[model samples]
Structures are given as C-alpha cells and as structure tokens.
Target: MSSQLLPRLAQEDESTDALSGPQTVTRQARPLRFITCGSVDDGKSTLIGRLLWDTKAVKEDQAATLRRDSTGQHNELGLPDFARLLDGLQAEREQGITIDVAYRYFATDRRSFIVADTPGHVQYTRNMATGASTADLAVLLVDARAGILEQTRRHATIAALMGIRQFVLAVNKIDLAHYDEAGFQAIAREFREIALSLGVRQITAIPVSALKGENIVLRGDDVMPWYSGPTLVETLEKATQRTGQSTGFRLPVQRVSRPGEGFRGYQGTVAGGSIKPGDSVVVLPSGVEANVKAIVTYDLVRNAAVSGDAITLVLDRPVDISRGDMIAAIDQRPQTGRAFTARLVALSPDGIVPGKRYWLKAGSRRQRVMVRPVSALDLATGNWDDAAVLALNGIGVVELDFEEDAIFDAYETNRETGAFILIDPDTLNTVAGGMIDSRRSRSGRFDALPDADRASITLPARLIEAFLKTEFARAHVGEIRVTRGEKE
Candidate 1:
C-alpha cells in the first residue's frame, strides 16, 4: 500500500456535497466510535484488518511481521493472515477465537474512527454490551454460508438495547459462497426483519470477502458490480454522533471540593442540558435549591457548560449538597423514588439471584438495592417470557428496591443518568448492567409531597370505592385524591 492513498481517501466529491446542500458546522472532528460484533469465526478481525491494511494505517514493519507469522497460511492473493493483526492474546490465538474486546484506532482522509472488535461467544455477551454502550453505530458481520445464527441475533438484540440506531450488516465470506448476490440479499432481508422488530430503523447491508479485501476499503466492483453502494469506510465517515440528552440540566455530584474554609464546589461532568451562571438548580433527594454562582474549569471561568464537559460548579448559597446527590433544574427535576423497574444484562458466572442485595452504582452514586426478576427477553422472537431468575448472559426485566431515595431519569431520556451496574456484595464482582425503564411503587403513588405530608393525606372510603368502579381508573389509577370541604 502506498502513502498516496491517504490523500485520495480524504478527498470528497464536490458535486455530491453541493447536491446534498450545506453541511452542519462542527467545532471539532470527533472520531466516530463503532464496534464489530457477531458469531464466532465470522471474520470480524479480518474485516477490520483489511480496512487498516488498505487504508495504509498499518506500518511496513508490522506487515513484515504478519508475513513472517503467516508462513504457509497465506491466501490465494498471497496476503498474510489478517486475523493475526487483532488476536493479541495468546489464549485467543491458540483457541482461534476472540475472547475479549480488542480496540483499534485508524483514520481516513475525511474522518477518524475508533473500532472495538468484540467477542462473539454467548458466554462473552457481557463484553459485547460493554463495547456497544458507547458506540455510535454497530457493524454486525454474518457468514455468507450461515445466514443468520442464534448468536447473530443475540448481538443485534444487545446492540439495539444499548441504544445503537445505525447498523451495518456486512455479509462476509462472499468468495466461499461463490459471490452469489442472491445469497447476500436473502441474509440481508432476514436480518432486516429482525432489526425492524427491535425498533431499529436505520440499516445498511453490504456483501464482502474480508480475506480477499473486497468491498471493505476498496470497492469490489470487478467481482460484484451488481451491488453498488458505499464501501465500509464511506458508511463510517457519513454516520452521525448520538444526539445529546434532551432533558433539563443535570450534574451528578462526584465530589465536594472544599479547598478553603468558606469555599465549597461541586465537581462532576454535565450529564444533560447546558448550565450557566445564575441558573436556579435543585439538589436532589434533599430538595435544597441553589443558584449557580460560577462555572469553574482549569483553564478559566466559563460562561456556560454543556453535556460531556467536566467542570466544577460553585453555588451561590451554602446548601446541603454532597457526592451522590444530583443537582438538576429547579422546575424539571428527575424522578426520586424508592423502587424502580429496569432491564438488566447478567454479567457474572453466578448470574442474578432474586431477592439478593447488591450494590448498584450509577454515575457517582452507590446504594444498596434488591433485585427481583420479572421477565426475560427472548432474543430470537423479541418477546418477554416469564422468568424468576436471570442466568449468566441472560437479559431480563427486574424491579429494583432501593434502601434510600434514588434519583434517576429514564434511560431513553438520558443515558448517563439512567445507566447503572450491579455488583455482588459477597464476591465484589459486577453481576449485571442495567437501564432504568420507569419508576415503580407498591402503592402506585408518585406524588411530589414530602414524606410527612404523604403520611397525613387520607382518601375517603366512598371516593376510593367510586374511583375503583370506573373502568379507566381500575387499570390506570395509581394515586389517591383528597379534597377538603368548602365553607358555606
């Protein structure tokens, strides 16, 4: 590969941009992060290696070592075993499978990329979730010979649940299938059905032979001219970043910095909407109100701060705020509750034990929680089946019982504040990764009254009986209503 290809890859077609209209202005070129995942021996490493090799991201010396290691294992094109580039672990090489997540960084002329090659075995589904949690897109590879396997659906389901909308189905090993276009289309159609059922709207399918370096970096027009679409590199450069949280300002206090006797600052990353000086914010759980005094950073005092920024916040008044408490917008605050419902992915060997106490960590807060599995997700059928316990690598819905008042937003509204991990108290290992679906209460009461006020409010017996008789109220009523009599 020549270094000259770099300039050629970076050059965009002027006509295409003009036809598409003006491009959105970006402050910086944030690398598009993605992950490659699917069943074992699906050519994930080979696809990534082909991408790096054709783009000249691999140095000559590294290629020389690959050639020496390959020995008699070179393909018909005389290329070295591309899988060797990513199988860094001795165990992985010996087993001929990816056992852990392998991350690789590479850049094209137009954009940079960070790709995580995740393991495909069912036992390592937790590793796949870890990579997909932060990815903007997921590239799922399927063997041309084996259309859609159980593990393929498992990866897709996990990726979609992690909030990845953009998907690329690379039908790898076209050469073994005689480069049959019909075979590729059949697999693409079946996968599209599964993707749509999972609520994924954006999908792109491509046919390629990773070992032969076809339709990966360079187009395989000579082999399959009938299939005309952007190459794998083009799909990545054009993909957009995940949208920011559309909720009100949120800052989960990581630490209380008290450098001086009279000065106290809350330090954390902005998890939601932007915040500015003088903004009225409320401390969660305690419900103490404070005004933003200053937005402090290492560089200087910033006028405003948006999501993804790590900074120190100074409140105007002395308030009872501490680590694990969330500082949110005064009017639009997140839900505070003692119980909630969430979807969890079991990550440990022992799996999730129902009615067991575990430490749940979300953002900077850690609290004791008891988990009760309600139902498990059927990946193949996209159905929820009754389950009493979640096994290893199993995904299920559960009820979370918190020992204290917990503050959180729906995972769909804010990924940062809604995501959490469960740790086993005895083993001290991560047992599950969970996302908050909604808050739940035994009494079905979610009013904003104080604990004392709630205890005092009582509903009339007649009103309760009448309300329960109504058809609409029977299934949906979750709150008690009471009104005082008016003076005549």
Candidate 2:
C-alpha cells in the first residue's frame, strides 16, 4: 500500500516435461500480479468475480447490490450473475460483454494477488496488451464446450510474447459439458500444445465452472473426484513470480530532483539489477561516467536498492544529466544505436503504417522514428510471413529507425528497457506496443532512413552524431573521417 516501488521476491518458474505438471509445497510466495484473457464469452469476468467472491473480497453491500441487480433475471443455476460484478460499464451490461480492462485485488490465507480482467473482444486487443505488459503470469480461459478457439491462441501468443512464462488454462463451464472429464482433458491437452510451442513450460490446466463457483478458490472435488490436481487458487498460490531483472544495472532518469541548495539527485525507479552508494555509474546517450554519491529515499538512506525500488541517486560529480537519459552501471551499459529490430502489436484501428513518422517512447526517452513492417505472425500457424503493413490486432516484426540515438536492451533480456510505445503525432493516441528484438547499425537497415532531401532539410548540421552513424559514413570509413571542429 506504500506508494514506493516493490522489492519483489525473485522466484524461479520451474518447467516440467508434462503440461499438467504437479504442484508442490510452495518454494516461495508473495503478492502476485496476473491477468485473465481469452476469446469472447469465455467467462473471464465471471472467473474473476468468482475469485473475489470465494476469497471473501466482496463486501455485504456489494453482494446485496448484485443480488438486487439480478432480481428478475435468472442464470442456469439461479445464482448471482457473476459477470455483472466486473462488467460495470453500461455498454458491457447491455451487451453482456466486457469492453474495458477492470482490475481487482484479492488475497488468500497463503498469498495476495492483483488480477486484471482484460476484455476478450478482438477490437480490445490493445486493452489486453496493456494488462499483460506488467503481469508476471497469465490466466488464459477457455470454454470447455468450444475447446481452443483462434482468439484463445491469439491471447496466449500475446501473453507469451510479453514474457509471461507461467500460464493457467482455465477450461471454464465444465458443468455445462455435463462434467465430462474426457472433454476437459481434450481441451487441456490442445492448449498445452499451444503453450509449449510458445516456449512456455509451466502450465496448469484446470476445469472450472465460474457461475457454479466450482474449482476456483474452493474445491469442486465433490463433483470432480477424478481431478486430484490442486484447485485454481492452489495453483496460483504456489505459482512463481517472473525474475525479469537478470540483466545488469539500468535506470532511466525520470527527473533531476533539487529539493534544496547543494543537493542534486536523480530520481527514478530502478529498472534492473542493483545500485548502491559509491557504485560506478554512467549517464547514457552522453557516455558521461560518475560514481554514486548516495541513494536517498523517504525511508532511511539505504546502502543498496534493487530492481523496482524507487529512490533518488546522488552522483559523485556534477554532470549533464536530465530526464530521458539513462543512468546505468558503467560496465554494463545498454545497446545504443539509431536502428533496432522489434516485434509489435498493432493496437489502433488505423494499424501501423510504413515510413510514417511517429513518436517512439522507450523508458524515459521519446524521439521521432520511422517504422517498417517486415513480417507479421500468423496466429494459427505461428509463422512469420512477409507483411507490408500491420492491420489492427496484428502481431508483426518491424525495424525502427530513430532520428536520434536510442538506448535499450533486448526485450528478452530486460523488459523495462526494451519495451516501447508508438504515439501518433496527429491524434497523440498510442498506436502500437513494440518489444525490442535487437539494436541494428544504421547500415544494417538500408530502407530505415528517410529520403535524403527530406532528411537533410529536416535535420540540421548540428545532428552530426546521427550523420556519423549513417550507412555512407560506415561504408566509406576511410574516405569519410571525423574530426572535431572547434567551437565557433
């Protein structure tokens, strides 16, 4: 509840050979962050409502209101309409579908959880992506009657692409299937194939009925005596949080704090690794190095702070540092380049256009960039095929050309430093979410640069740093030599 960032426990997500792997005595437990997703009418909102309801998170007043809302209507079980608990929007209530991401918090005696109930409609894929971006795990639901649909696979692909290794395939509405164990197993098996192919190893597929409140937090063993596996809550209780900060130190400076005279500090959340007083640090994009003078916070000055910790850092010497510059470990600086390969989730109705100039913001830095679609992923086949443009809800790989130097680590290596968003200049709305694949040299992407006339006119002679990174400069290294012209 303290607004400061977390010192999250690093727990390993152990993979097993089988998809329906065994749950063990929890090696670790802590407050977890996760999301629920899948195709439409998969009972995602109902599952979340069931989770909250079973955990006693719903107060008496809320329950009474829900009962009043369901006075005339009757479900198959004559129970409270669980979906209404989260589908608070008028449109959602009228249409009986979720349109936006609704977040809910609940806890068990064993651990706590923060669950984001993302929409299942294809148009709301961007909303789902926003929820999955920060989730450590994904709860992908499926209809026991329908098995795995195209959208189910799509949601799994997006979640895996966002680096969620732990997945729970909730085969919902089992009661509607007449409690058919064979049907549940069949659906669970197919989903495992998809999850494993995505490089996700830890998967727990459970049969559930959200409306009946079976197999969610409490056991449905009375009905499903064959399923000796743990309940959904049990699986979540022992599930591990992703250790996403394996890469070395990285800090994207948010702002320079000067609370009083003679006290200058850099404030930002530590994105990766750890930092301590006297640590050697480098201000990126400028390559100016300094040592840590101190680490300050509202709490007592600490000797060290790890990833996700929000604190102010005082450097040993005065340096040209500001918002949008990275303060990273001197020995482990992130890749700085003018071009990079990235995978993108096209989020807007207009889709992502080729050669369009948009604001590309990664971490604290925002700059003009030209994006070129290379290939889009076929969700059904999981193949990367040639693509000229990314349509809405399309997942594609593209190359990003930056107008200025950009710093990032591969998203597989560091999520915080490697992820970025594209903002349309005209509307100022986010159009896409991109994950860095690898930073490329300017020459690596022949078409990443704009037309020479437009480039030359738009960029001034003062943009010499970028000019030096151009293909011509690298290609004619011996002919084109750089010498510092003295200050005029």
Candidate 3:
C-alpha cells in the first residue's frame, strides 16, 4: 500500500449510457473494516479463525502448525483448536484469552474485509475502543448458554458511541444449546432492544457454531433447517460502508511547504467538502481571506479535490499561514471559543484527573487544557450519573478550558473536525479520546457585549484594582481601562 496521507474513498461511483459509448465498469468496493467484540471466553477468536480457515486464508504450513499445537485436543468434529490460529502470543496461548487487539485480513469473490479481534476483559476495554474507533461495523458475539452479560452491553454502547451504525449479533456455540431455535431467538430479541435504545436501526442476528463450521461461510442446513437467512460472510459482503461528512470545506493545515523561494503551499488532507481553484477561503483565528490559486498533488495539478484527497493548496495572495490553522470556506466556519463541553472515554490507568492541566490535541493543533468531569455514563442502564473524576475505561462528560481560542464542530455533525484526544503532559501518553459536544464562552461578560460597541466598553476602576491583585490577572491581563461617570 502507498504511504500517502490521503484518506481512502469508501466507494466509487460509476455511470453509463448506451447511446454514449461502451459500458462503464464499477470499481471494486474498498475493504470493509469491522470488529468482533463481547465478553471474555465468548469465542471471538474462534469465530475469526473459522472465518479465515473456511475462506482459505490460512496456508498449509499454518494449518500443520495448528494441528501440532492441538496434538492432544480436538473438537467433536475432529478439527484442531481454531483459537490457536489467532492466539499468537505465548501468554495468550497459555491463558487462552486475548490480551491485545489482533487484526486479520481476508477476502471473498465479491468483496474484501479487515477484521479486528478485540479483547473482552474489563481492563482491556480501552483496547476494544481503540479497535472499534475506525471500524465501520461491529460483530458482537454472545454465548448461547449465557445470554447477555454486562460486558456485552458495555461493548455495544461503546461501539454505538464510536459511530458504528451496523451491528451483527453472533449467537455462537449454538451446538452447545442443542441447536434450539427458541434460545437463539430470545438472545437476538434482547440484543435488538439494547441496540434500538442506542438509536441503531441496522442489525442482523445469526446463529453460528464457529467450532463446527456452521453458518460462518456456509449454511448449517443439515443442523438447523429453520435458519433460512444468509451466512455471516454474506451479511458482511452486502453491508454498506459508513458515509462521509456532508459539512462545508475544512482543511487543517499540517505544514507549510516551500520548495523554492517564490513557491508557497499549504499541505494537508481535505477533511470535509470539496475545493477548487478560485474558490474563496479564509484562514481561521486570524480571519484573513484569500482565493485559491491552484490545487497541487503529487500526481498532477488538479482543478478540483474532494474529501479524503491529500493535496497542496496554493493561495492567490501571501498571508500568514502555519500548522494547526484551519483553512475553511468563508461562509460556513466552525465554532471558535476558549472553552467547550465534550464526551470522552478515559483510557489511562490514572484516569482523567479533575482540575489537572493536560494537552488536548484536535486535528493538527495541540494546546493546554484543563478537564473537569461533570457526569459519568452507566453503560449497563444507559443513564448518566454525577461524577467528579473518570476512572479507567470510564465514559463521561467533561468541560474543557483552553488557554487559546479553539475551533471545532459538534461530533454529530462532522466527526473529522469534532473529535480530539487528551495527552498527559508528564508521561506524554494518550489518556483519553473525546468528541466535541458544544462550545462554551470563557468570559461571559465579553461575549454579551455588542459587537459594534465592544471597542468602547470599559471596566470599573474598583473591579480592575481588585483583579490586578490576583495572580491570574498578573499573568493574563493585557489591557485595563477605568470607566467613570461624569461628576454631577
């Protein structure tokens, strides 16, 4: 694969007319990215291993090693342990549990797939979120013997919050349930209710036996004739890719490139909308306006570029531009403020500390911010509870106070520009992944002032004198004015 900064196109569009010329051919759909998650011992690894085995993704040498590893163990059908194919680590092999996220790739005649096998242990929930963050769909496994567990609900909630709209409830180990159709139905119905509560409408529940190779890549007509639905592979091949953002143009400048003294260009991927030559653009924060002179790419000079295309942008006039400054359409600009509210998943062991200063990185910008937790999400009951701090694997709402003006959009509107991550300054480790909820003004009085009269507004002498005595005023105060009414 090319190591380009361009985003991958979800799908290609093709059209043809009989009178015009020869028929146009449709391009192959991009590989579908999906994740398999549930509670520990839920057979997640087995399901993925079976899928790879049946699809001929495993080589002969790998199969021989699996047989050797399972010399003393075999399923009822005389098949070697399927989990061995994925549990590559020595610790994982000995414990028979996944500790880290394992990614595997396979393909069918119609389409291709990239699947992530995530850990189910409660402590590894953060690892699961890391896998699901980029997945377009999720495959949630449930043991037929044990219907729905707390971890099952937790994974579902996190997947939905990460913007995965498509779900597949795999009721695995069906053979252990005597292939009872009622048991499968009950589990499927319960999961559907949970999915519905999360505003997820697209879901498909299927009965599967990963150990016996039933209803994975092939139908289990011999065992359960009642299931007339498609196999797991079929559902995946027919699923659709997640749609991109429909918002206006946004390009967060990554770097400034000057190959020669007279040439200057801004380099970054188009995060949203399309851009073309002569289009009016604005440099945010500074509010400098300019027109596009040209669009430059490694391949050729293009007239237009859409979302996901990485290209260099040349402006018609010289203006101050640098990394982290956004180049956006003049008419539709993102929110700019000093404070904002957000929802984040706490990933570090120390969790998110209240009133602690950390580095908040969004797009290409990184700035100092203080985080305060307001509420914690109860994944089991789908309710928010009062919280002062977020623990490991905890999800909560927080208030972020920034030292400088920040730009963003609501995550529900455009994920590319609305998502951010918090880094611990001391350790330089990522502590949380957050989504922008809304913007909040730092100075309420300043925002309430009329735009036309802001220049004439003045502070009271008493208030100014008292403020100047404080440490915050000494560090942040730039200008002070005293207002006095005319003496009568």
Candidate 4:
C-alpha cells in the first residue's frame, strides 16, 4: 500500500530465548501455519522475529548473531535486524528486503507456528499467493502513520479470494508514530472498511510496535490506553486452526512408501477429516474401493489419525492406488472430475489468456489444464470486464479444463482440498492461485436465465421487434414474420 522506505538504524540488542524441548502439549503436533502480507516495510518480518525471540523459539546462537549484526553500532542506537531475521537468503540479505516466501518455524506454550513471511512488494505478488494458499490465517500489517495503502488492500483482497477470511490486522510501527490514538484508530477504521468490503468478517486490529517489542509477544504499557485486547501472540494462540469436516476421509496418497523392509503402505497427511482402521475407503479419480486394514504411524499403530497427521495406511485388498489417487471414505466420496470452475488471481505479468495450457497442482496431484477465461475482475477497482488476457495481480473467474480427473471439495466446504494453483509448464513457476466457489451447484442456473422474457420486459416493443428481426435473420429460417408491416 504505502511506499515506506527502508530506514537505516543504529545497532540494537535483540534478546531471545534458548531453544529447549517441544513447547506444546500435543505430542509431535504440527505448528499453526500463517502468512503475513501488507504494504512495503509494514514490519511483517520484525513482528514475527520479535515473537520468536521473546517466546524462546529462536536458537541462542542464531539470536546472538542477529543481535550482533543489527543495523547500528550502539545497542541503544542500533536498529533491529528485522529484515535479516527472516530474509535468510543471500540475495534477500544483499537487497535488505524479503524477495520470496521466507518460511520459518517457532513455538509457544500453547501452539507452534510455521510463519510464511511473504513479500509485500507489488511486483512479487506470485510469491504472496504461494505462501497464503496454505495459510490458516492471514496476518496483515499496516503502518499506523500511512494507514491502509494500496498494497495492503491488494493483499487483503487476495487473501479473501484465496479463501482466507481470518485476518490479524496489525497496526504496526506505533512507536514511530508516537502511539497516537487517532492515528491508530484512523488506520484501523480504514483497514476495517476494506476488510469488510473484501468479505473478511473476523478481523482484529491491534496497535503494535514491532521494533520496540511492544504488544507483540508481550503486551506493552506504551500503546493506546483505551484499547484492551489480546496481544498479537495471545490473539494468534486463541485463533482456531482450519480443518475441513466431512464424513469422507481423504489422503492424497503421496507415494506408496516404496515397499522397503516389509512395509508397503500409503504415506500422506490426512487431507480432510479423520480415518480409522476398518473404515471403507475409495480411491478416487479412479473409482476403486478398498477397506483400510491399518492406520500406521512410524512408531506406533494408530486406530485413528486426524487431518494433518502424516502416516502410512494399509488396505485390506491391494488396489490400483497411486500418488494422485484420493483415498476417501466410501460413503461420503468427494466430487471427482476432470474439469472445474474457480476464482483465480493471475500472478504473471503476461496474464491468463483463454485456451492457454498450464500445469494444475491440487494437493499432491498434478494435471495439464487448458484454462478458459470466464471473466476478469480488476483488483484495484473490482470491475468485472472481459479481456483477452488477465495481467499480474488481476483477479477473475476461470474454468480449468483438466486432462485427468481428481477429487476436490468446494473451498467453502474445505479449504485444504478446495484450493489449487496454476504453474507454467515451461518455467515451473506458479502463475495463479485459485479457490473453488462452492455456492454454485452442479446445475447451470445462471446461464439458464430466461433471456427472452428479461429482454422483452426491459426493452421497448419497437426495440424488441428490431432485436427479434435481427435474430431471425441471423438464424436464417423462413417464418411468419409479424413485424411493423403486419401491424400497419
């Protein structure tokens, strides 16, 4: 949104915790995954870095190095190494900005986190889409001084488009802006309106100073006195993790765990719901059915495993199951098809053109697809206009006609199974990210509108006659043409 320049700061001390044992109660539990996106220099990296440092998620040596390498010479005068915290790449280090999706891991007492620090620059929107696609929640940072900028709006709109409605709108850098109540409220109001317009109902705006380590992991006494809400860390811990509910159990069988050492089983994270031993399963896109003989983890045998658990499964009868086949519950089998329609954001500069071929990736399954552009919407203006091609950051609707069939649910029904991305076959770079709008049923109701009645009701009789005459002539059928001549 706002073009906030990178300011060189004097060096500062970044205190951190010593890495210890597993932080959460759930044994071998996976961390909550989230992506941060907003205007340039909105302090996304700094916020996350602070959270990790305060929560003892960072290793001691790494934290020490980060502190030593901070911007300025004196600890008090030095600027925090916020950008360097997540910009682990050499190129990013040299550029002093996040270039791609920099993934990092951290943990707290209540939960662990896989933070995808996405780039805020408008040019690198594709990277943002990749990071946000798998996120359970989107944390949007807004500079208190600048308020809601274009990039912030664009990121929020994209997150919503990608089926992410939960947002933590961090009004960051409040210290620099003097923690002005009016400034914080102004920015919050602006972003609230934008988030609401973009269909985000649950957004919590917190005034935070990521640089000063205020209201991030630990609540600060310096911010707005009127505000009384959970700090960023508290809020994140309280947020519910996303998982789809279905009677059907699905695991996009990754690879038959190479029958090594008397072990021939399917290895994959449960894509949706839970699966147990003795449950009837169906391998979809192939329509083969089998009963689960055993749900095996590496160490112990599990009667049931929930979604997100990576384990190998054994079936009673050997069936033709492969990498792409979706192993779902027999009774509640998900819809499987070769073609599907979706709302997509074209990530490339050349844009998405109709009848263009791209590699479609859903879960672990891949297919060559021909995208038929149904329509294109301008992200900045929300205008639905048709174009031969959709450019970078262009949001629109498209129908992906795939060469092979695969199982998928609606995004609203299940985000994990309902989302997908398009990749360039040549470059192998992702070109677009999409969400399947589940509201529309299989029937084509919108396309089957009573156009004749609508036209007659809306148009004048003279214009309707002219339209009918034009259509009849176009049809080239000899008929009783009741026109103005018959009336006369």
- Top TM-score model: 2
Candidate 1 lDDT (Cα, whole model)? 0.84
Tens-digit per-residue lDDT, 1-488, candidate 1: 11111111221432121111223322225677899999999999989988989999889999999899899988888888888888899998778788889898898877888899999998888889999999988999999999899889989988887888778899999999999999998998898888888787677788989998888888999989888776788777666667647679999999999999988899999998888999999999999999999999978999999888899999999888889999999988998999999999999988888777799999999999878888998877778999988988888998888889989999888889889999998888999999999998745332322233333345666876786697656665555444555641
Per-candidate TM equals: 0.85, 0.87, 0.84, 0.76
User: For every candidate structure, what is the RMSD over all alpha carbons to the true structure, in angstroms?
Assistant: 8.6, 5.9, 8.5, 11.3
Clashes of each: 0, 0, 0, 10
Per-residue CA lDDT of model 4 for 346-378, tens digit only, reads: 887777756667888888888897776667766
Which digits, one per residue and each the tens of the lDDT, describe model 2 over residues 157-244?
A: 9998899988888989999898899998888778888888889978888889988888898889989998877678887776667777
> Using TM-score as the measure, what is the rank order of every candidate, best first?
2, 1, 3, 4
In candidate 3, position 50 carries an lDDT of 96
* lDDT of the structure predicted as candidate 4: 0.74
Query: Which of candidates 1 and 3 reaches a greater TM-score?
Result: 1
Superposed by TM-score, candidate 2 places the C-alpha of residue 187 at a distance from the truth, in angstroms, of 1.8
| TM accuracy, model 1 | 0.85
Off by over 4 Å in 2: 1-30, 447-488
Better of 3 and 4 by TM-score: 3
